[model samples]
Target chain A: MLLLVLELAGTAVFAASGALAAVRARLDVFGVVVLGMTTALGGGVIRDVLLDVSPPTTLRDWRYLLVPAITSLAVFWYHPQVARLRRAVLLADAAGLGLFTTAGTTTALALGAPVYTACLIGMTTGIGGGALRDVLLREIPMVLRKEIYALAALAGAAVVALGDRLQLPAGPVSVVGSALVITIRVLALWRRWHAPVARGLDG
Target chain B: MLLLVLELAGTAVFAASGALAAVRARLDVFGVVVLGMTTALGGGVIRDVLLDVSPPTTLRDWRYLLVPAITSLAVFWYHPQVARLRRAVLLADAAGLGLFTTAGTTTALALGAPVYTACLIGMTTGIGGGALRDVLLREIPMVLRKEIYALAALAGAAVVALGDRLQLPAGPVSVVGSALVITIRVLALWRRWHAPVARGLDG
Candidate 1:
């Protein structure tokens, strides 16, 4: 099905970002692989665990594991050239984020989640893996620190919600909604954009 | 009441180990506290989440949060002395591992977990935080790859199983089991003891 292909593509792109992050950390082959694998599968694992779905998805489907492994190998072997393509990599990651957020939240909603909970799960699905990867890397998580990161997920999720409300076919809704997220995210990163903040914490 | 005290002591020691580990990682004050909190509470978080207990212990009880914070501040101030007391820190950590393993498995067994699963959880409870810490540090997990780590938990859990078979009081049995684990771990570390297959892998 198209959904399966979308899932694998999203996972592979996410894994590349994870591997790229690891290279910046000067991690070896093993650490890079671990980072990539965890980033690729972490959101779904958290989703499954929170949902109390025993024997989480990563365990049930071998593709979930294989996608990350293959991606990691590709990144490791071609890192120098790949690093040069940061813009391409970031764009791919944005696409992955949009797709994953749509798929994960929509699935949760269909599985009987309340709308609010579904929204949270959608955001989590979009950002949870990267957050875990950053935390393990001992860096402040992008999900928390980057204002636009989770906000993009929220925007896509709202579009998905409106589409569902209007009884639109999922295919069209998914593409449009995911595009919104990708555009917002890429623009934010490229522009070094940040949300408005009232600074001045007491020292 | 006595069991409560023992649990607090174990948590404190676990928090201390986390602080020590984070210090080595060169984290700042807030990072040290966060790492310590994770070290102390991470195992229980995993257990509760897996068991579908809402909100987990750290949220339910303020002590879990504050204890690690206080421990972190102490470490921040007296880091030099703490460095000189590495042997003592190791001993305390060993003691914590033994106690947590017995206590964690006992709780699981009480909640009607299968004996083998309880034992597995017990081992995880003992070392899960450390594994997470290392993962965040992007290091090979000390608990997984090296040391007399999970083995100590297995030994204590086996003791608890035997004690249950003999209809021993759970409290005394837990203490004895924990003592056994601590003894084994201390002796192993002190004697430069090791697991089999310490040979170098193919490079």
Candidate 2:
């Protein structure tokens, strides 16, 4: 299904971004790989736990582990090449954000979560790992600081929910949904769009 | 009840450990406190969310936030004195491990988890935050590597289960359970005990 493709791509890209952050922080190889794995799998693990499913999908499908591990080593070995394409990496991360947010919302709905809780879970699933990672690194999260992060995820999830309510076909809806998210995120990045913080950035 | 007192003490001690780790990781004052709060409260949050309890205890109780924040500041300011009494700190941590494991098991039972699952969850609650904190700091987690960490938690949880079956007085059972955990952990530390890895430390 189109959903599977989007999920796979999104997982790899998100893992790449997390591993990249760990490398930038000068973490060891195992640490880099660990961060990558968690970034790829953390959201889904939280979802399964919330949904009370044992032996979660990530564990059931060990492909989930292998993907991030391979990709992180590739990133680590090709550090110079990756560094030159930092902008491209960010765009891929945006793609990942959109993919994950929509998938999270869809998963919650399938599991019969109420709409509002579904939305919150989707947002948490999209951003929780990155937030945790950034907090540990002692820097403001990239999501917190830049590129209309949560907004883009929220928009994508809302669109997915709307499409489902309209009884749209799963394939076309996923394509359109992901495209919409990627387009919005890329434009936001290009325009340097930022959130309006409390009291006009008075914090 | 005495059991409740021990659980509260364990929470406080674990929060202190998180604050201390943050200090070593060079977090600023507010950051230190938040890290401590997260470490102390995260496992319980996971437990509640898994049990489908909305908003978690940390959000419901003001004390959960206040306790860690105040303790973090106090510990940060008094690290020099605290460091000088390392043995006492270890003893406190061992006692905390038993207390948290027991509390986690009890909560899981209250929520109708099976006995085995309760025990597993109790161990997770006792060690999860520390594991997360280590990963954040880019270090191998001590809970996973050093001492008889999970085993100690397991033993204490077993004691609680046995105590309930025997209808022992809560006060006496808690004291015996805590003392058992501390003794095992202390012995493990004194003897440089480690889990036998299949690969014999090839990492």
Candidate 3:
């Protein structure tokens, strides 16, 4: 039940980001909706696909689809107000990133995936939506270009994998893992931290 | 047997395209290999995921992985020669598109998917790799911006779907469908056919 709620919330936040991007790009209403849905669902879908989950849980449940659709439409109608709340959105996005990464890692571990694969899936789950949205909008993915995003997710996933190997309880381990991700992301954002670019490329 | 051969050939062609794109983008060696693998396997992975095929055939088979890895390395070493064969590469890409689209539609149909779903999967299978490649290269997907690429794939997929509905033999149906896609793509390239853009967007 908690996981479901977190997933829905994450979907809404990601959808909002996608909708905002679409509006900025001057996409039509249909394009806005499509991009929103893709952004919200892309990560989970990628995770599920890697884990061999058919049809994906998001596709199986109408609520998952509805959350993004409604959220996108809401953003479309009231974007100015929504954009004004950018700080809140960023914070919520960090929370979403944490929740998705931990959840993806946990799910992969449950499914008997190797530790390394699970960690990769977890990072992918956290960053895949934003990557897809950027791709659709013809921009370099923020995670790829500059950000502590993917590394944070990977770190959190590693914590989960470590906990699993140590035979720790899942519930507390998940909480700690998620907190780690959220902290790292929020701090990175606050400090404006960036991943280094390829050296000597400009020369 | 034939399908396997087609799939391998398609993977190689897509890998070449991706490696060439990565070289043009000035990605490092690691990025070149990763992009090549992603392009070669992406479409098939998407199709398999949608159809509930666990582990995706590309991931399960060593040959599928090996082909792209080798192809990318070859392209990385001899990019100038590869670039010089642009015409040949384009033609091969068209053939790959045809084979993948028809094969994807057939696979979905075999899994008892609805006709519309099968057609979409088929089109995705044909175009998903190139879209991923473009996304990674920070360019708008060629299919979305201009060209008859996706439509040609969709039309071919529809042919296969129609053949299935009519209870035609899979062999001849696939051949005809693939031929339709190849013909349309080749003609589109020769005649410079393009999909219409959104009207009044420039203004």
Which candidate gets the maximum DockQ versus the true structure? 3
| Cα interface RMSD of each candidate | 8.5, 9.2, 5.2
lDDT tens digits by residue: candidate 2, A1-203:
66787788888888888778766766555556656766787777777776666534653465666787798777766766777789988888878777777778778878888777776777777776676556555667777787577877777777777877787865676667667778888998898776766685654
Expressed as tens digits, the lDDT of each residue in A1-203 for candidate 1 is 77788878989999999988876666656557667877888787788786675435553576777889789867877787778899999898888889888877777777888777877887788888888778777778877887888889999888887787788887778778789999999999989997877767654
User: Once model 1 is optimally superposed onto the true structure by TM-score, how far is the C-alpha of residue A4 displaced, in angstroms?
Assistant: 1.5
Taking every candidate in turn, the Cα RMSD to the unseen true structure, in Å, is: 7.7, 7.9, 6.7
Cα RMSD for candidate 1? 7.7
- Across B1-203, the per-residue lDDT of candidate 1 in tens digits comes to 67767877777877888888888989998888888888888887776664456788655888777777798779877888997998988888888788888987787677666566567567667777777777766765655344467667789998887787688899999999999999988898889876532112222
Q: Could you arrange the candidates by lDDT from highest to lowest?
A: 3, 1, 2
Q: What is the lDDT, from 0 to 100, of the residue B184 in candidate 2?
A: 92
Task: Provide chain B's TM-score, model 3.
Answer: 0.94
Overall lDDT per candidate, in order of appearance: 0.78, 0.72, 0.84
| Per-residue alpha-carbon lDDT of candidate 3 for residues B101-124, written as tens digits (9 for 90 to 100) | 999999999999999999999999
Give the lowest summed-lDDT range of ten residues in model 1 chain A: A53-62
Record all residue pairs in model 1 with backbone atoms less than 3 Å apart, i.e. clashing.
A136-B136
lDDT per residue as tens, model 3, A72-131: 999899989988998878887787788889888899889877676677678778888988
CA error at residue A3 for candidate 3, angstroms: 15
True contacts kept of 2: 0.03
Those runs of model 1 whose alpha carbons end farther than 4 Å from true positions after fitting are A144-147, A189-194, A199-203, B1-16, B19-41, B51-128, B131-203
